[model samples]
Target: MMRTRFAPSPNGPLHLGHAYAALVAHDTARARGGSFALRIEDIDGERSRAELVEEFLLDLQWLGLEWDGAPIFQSHRLPGYAAAGERLKAMDVLYPCNCTRAEIAAAATKFGPDGPVYPGTCRNRHVDPTGAAWRLDTGRAMALTGPLEWVDEIAGRRDATPMIFGDVVLLRKDLPASYHLAATLDDAADGVTLVTRGMDLFPASHIHRLLQALLDLPVPTWLHHPLLVEPDGRKLAKRRGSPSLGDCRRAGEDGRAIATALREGRFPAGISLSQGIHQTP
Candidate 1:
């Protein structure tokens, strides 16, 4: 059975971009006689707002998106993440690093899709596990997994080259798991077969594919759709003060009508679709 999910963090309001992504996941599942699931990525205790979770549920309901069951919260799956981390440790592909942002910025000589790639300062050092993040030794991991590939609905088959991101973090010092670790596990746990998300996150599939290979998890196809952006080509984000679904709902706007307009590619004035990755500014 085909299953899709729209996993969103509850750190901010759900903007138009989020609505489009949700609709893409929901419509795709419904069209194929599949199930659509929602996952609340609220593990970041410092940033995730408890109030926003309810608001997000209300927003999705207002948009007429009925998920298969109650939303799965990442916070409830810490022990699973911890167990996964230990498995990776047994594989000897995980290493602890205490590098601060300032330290990495000063030492990093290369930049990846996300930001300054880690210079592997702690790769050879035995850092204290206390308050240290666990980073995947991508080179070592690739050596173990060999070459890998994943299928995308739009991009077709592509080789998995996770090295571009360098050694990515699987577990954070403050959080039990990073986005890559938690999301990949949660999707597999929910039996999601199609991972629908924005094009901006297309690069992340490389890492996720590698994780699947290491963890012996089931692989899923992906659909990286274009994002709704501002006239300036910047993706609509909550931090950018983009108009949110809540704002629209409170203004007496019809959620279904808005969804229909989005499905028809008829965005509101000043909002457009961006096919490429845009820097959040």
Candidate 2:
């Protein structure tokens, strides 16, 4: 059976954008008689909040979306991430990185697709690799995998070009696993067959496809939905004061009604959906 997941971080209460993303995965699974699961990405020790995790569940329940089994927490899966990191290290495709953000920014000559690609400052520093953030040598890894490709339900076939991110971080400075490593591993671990997310993340999928090849993980189809934007064309973000779903629920608004409006392409005041082409639900 098809399996999809709605994975959200517990750093803040979910907003309408998150609601639409989750609804896409939920309704897609239901439409195909597939399984829907929820995963809590709380590995960020600095920002993750236990209270927000509970609120996430409550908000989803209020939305009338049912998920299978208990929600998976990234915090509980650190050892697995560590193991994966070790595997990449053994393969010699990953190296220790010790450069600070300021140092990289100063040394970067030009920005790549994802911000300034690391200048590989520490790529040959010969420092002790332990307890340091790890980076995937995208060029070297791609040489091993040769050519690769992935399919999106909306955008169709795409050749994987992870080098655009340069040497991407596999383990973060503040956390054991980076989003590229954890999300890829988690999807395989949860048996997710379809990866549904926002169009803004379409580029990250390139890096993810490379990781799957390196780790020998299961491949899943992707569905990148349009983003929810403000009137100024800025993406809605919790850090930017976007209203949370809990706020609407507490205001006695109907969750199902809001979800229905989103599904039917209706928007609330001060909000607009992205102009990106739609994908089948």
Structural similarity to truth (TM-score) of each candidate: 0.97, 0.96
Tens digit of lDDT per residue, candidate 1, span 13-32? 99999999999999999999
Candidate 1: list runs displaced more than 4 Å: 277-281
lDDT of 1 at 58: 85
**CA lDDT of 257 in candidate 2?**
89
The pairs that clash in candidate 1 are: none
**Location of the lowest summed lDDT over 10 successive residues in candidate 2:** 272-281
Candidate 2 local distance difference test against the native = 0.90
Could you give candidate 2's per-residue lDDT for residues 28-93 as a string of tens digits? 999999999999999888799889988899899988899998999888899999999989999999
